[model samples]
Target: AQPQEGEIIGGKEVVPHSRPYMAYLKIKVKDRSGSKPSSCGGFLIRPDAVLSAAHCVLKVTVILGAHNINVQEWSQQRIHVTDWVIHPNYSSASLQNDIALLKLRSRARINENVTFISIPRSNEHVRVGTRCRVAGWGDTSVYGSTTDVMMEVDLKVQNETLCQQEFHDYQRLSMICVGDQNSGKSTYEGDSGGPLVCNKKAHGIVSYGPSGRLLPLVFTRVSYFVPWIRQQLRRFALQELPASPSSQ
Candidate 1:
């Protein structure tokens, strides 16, 4: 968890191409020495926009229509985004406001193998205990090798009060606490920047968790940022925004 690489360790393989909106990311994070390649997951929200975690944004290449990322499957569409926007108030220290939107250089050609997921309406809310699932490719056990095949795990939304006690910085209005308290069987966090889908809508975004081990996961509550998302989407649709921000 120490801000080192984080991905899921184990999950059930999802049917290939079943989650058409999935976006596999290849990222290079530059440091004083150089950079290192990292991976994360995301989801298509529009023909030209993808939603992901702010911390995961960088020199990113997105692969859509991917099931087996290891193989250049026929359905894949690799793309570089035209723009990236990390929430203005994003914080590395606290991991607050950890959401971002990316505009594609080219509109995605939607098909059975590629499409977009629905974002919640402004101010809409998901209830505690609501069942949801997160999907990605790299969920595995510690010391387990990363798997290229997409995988997913089912989870349930938890009470905010518990999260408040566990994470001193927890913000109920902006973040969601997820995992199963009974089984602790669903602390899936590898799909950072991936969607927390509930009833077919993306209600949350994979965000930071405890640095080293699996605990209940936290997600950026997408409902709280619907206004901002819509504003950015309008700009992306109108082509009126200034130059995109970098690795921001």
Candidate 2:
């Protein structure tokens, strides 16, 4: 959906998290008069890697340290994108397995402000009502536009049973739901593929919308995709090393 003006529409307040580990992804698209460069939210997984929605990375120059409202002001870091691996089962229309991993040309320097978040282990269940954090550089106002600086919000977990009931057939085991229908604040567009962290660990990746016209948000559970993540990490690790002496 397109961005609109106004901070809180229908009583919802869009803001950033206090201590966010997320980064704004400024995608440099084809230069067109009247067409702004596309932007999305993402987070560091390892010093040399980034995690974002597959759809966000499709044909774009990713710039780290981007903000939500000031595209021109934010500093563009090193241009480094060796490869992008989208989940094999990703479906654009359905937003299923909509995650992607980005390998950088060089490792990102981790400081107090920039660091990787821990991924939830396989089968790790985050119970309903648990507080989880969602961060992004997406729009603060509904239909407004994406921002240059990152923002975050706190949301409560929704159980699988309720998620199934709400999403029905569209919901997959890899997805999880969060937020309160009554709460006016929740994640929005451009937040897809960002992390849903709890207890300082990434439990899910922002995937779909609020389900109904007025509901919460849905995410692809990280636990269900732990094996895939490990496999990717292993592949990346192998590629990083030099040939063994015996092989040489």
Candidate 3:
């Protein structure tokens, strides 16, 4: 489907791609009118939780499903967020430590179509040149706005040495680099907080701009933040609802 206004699309053509891995994240920020729906791409990590870039949750509302921007089909199972937790160290100017967790008011109904992606275990390594997939409802073209239909792009992990040199002063252990300068495929502004997956498991969260003279897509490595993530999960556990029979 072609992306409509305030939607993310990959150019004009509607390419055939998989949609299940991409979660439609609808966020309603404070003071946002219902008509101006703010959305980003995210992936499910736990039964009732989602992992996205910290910046995406700035005063937000979340919606799962609904890949087409023009339609609200996925609204049927909306997960209203009761809490948003941004990384304690996140800084807006540098966009560092840009990670966050969303706590849903209730558990999501899981089925074949709705499931969670595994988070990378601590110390899990995805080396340079590893082929990975990134999906999001972000703007396809630079000048064009965001798209409604979720888009996918194939990427190769870049060597850390090269990435550091390219990003200059801002790169760190928390981030992973991916994308191709010649491939004509890349991530845009609204694509922040999306996932970069491999083997159906989430390896990173889209975080920073790409490297070199031109910005490339940088993802925050999930494994590197496992300790911090565990702490957040533990903190949220205090308010978690008992697992439903279906979840067990």
Candidate 4:
């Protein structure tokens, strides 16, 4: 049987706002008039910047914070997206360098329900079999309907050799593989651009996996892109910083 297009396999519900940095990316259809909104997951790395998958950026309307898709709550804050930055070398065909940044029109206020997550240091890499957490509001089963509440699952970093076999295009230096061979916990549809956190640091960005079964999930290795991420942040900071008054 063909695996369902999107959803988590063998995962549990997560407490609302527990993962404060998580951002819900909604793609609005301009002409569909009354069509259901399509969504993807993202994470906040800065007050005004959201890290997400490049593929999810097209026609994205807004970033919802303290979000739980199924309900309207006082904790929810919506920020319009002002712009976006995609990696220069991102490849749609190979899904390499599959990361992007969404610039918020206004900065998000930090509070208990809205915060940022730290990215792994440039030289850091979690050892194989290291446990990590991935959270999102995606489907609960293959081809199953998506959930309104968020979900989280534990996965272990897999061996490069094993991952390479499963994902023929897997590039160890640029990608990290994670999955639970025993529990079958993996991210499916609607999870792209979400964080793979280890030791309270984001080590990967949910990239892709087999469409049907929960075998090995590939992510954009955060450590490998630290330099690029820093460059973007620095550029934005410089642009937004007030210029010093020139001496008369």
Query: What are the per-model numbers of colliding residue pairs?
Result: 11, 16, 17, 3
Judged by whole-model lDDT over C-alpha atoms, candidate 1 comes out at 0.83
lDDT of each: 0.83, 0.67, 0.69, 0.81
Best by lDDT: 1
lDDT of 1 by residue, 1-248 (tens): 22122334334778889999999988988888899878889999988899999988989999999998989999999999879889999998899999999998998999999999998987788999899989986556545446778878788899998789789899999999988754434434357899999999999999966655566789999999998988778777667446654221
How do all models score by TM-score?
0.89, 0.81, 0.82, 0.90
Q: Write the per-residue lDDT of candidate 3 for residues 31-97, one digit (tens) a residue.
A: 6445455767777777667889887885555555555656756433576788878889988777778
lDDT of 2 at 194: 78
- In TM-score terms, candidate 3 sits at 0.82
Higher-ranked by TM-score: 2 or 4: 4
| Ranked candidates, highest lDDT first | 1, 4, 3, 2
What lDDT score goes with residue 11 in model 4? 70
Candidate 3 RMSD computed on C-alpha atoms after optimal superposition onto the true structure: 4.8
When summed lDDT is taken over every stretch of 10 residues in candidate 1, the lowest stretch is 1-10
**Residue-level lDDT for 182 in candidate 1:** 44
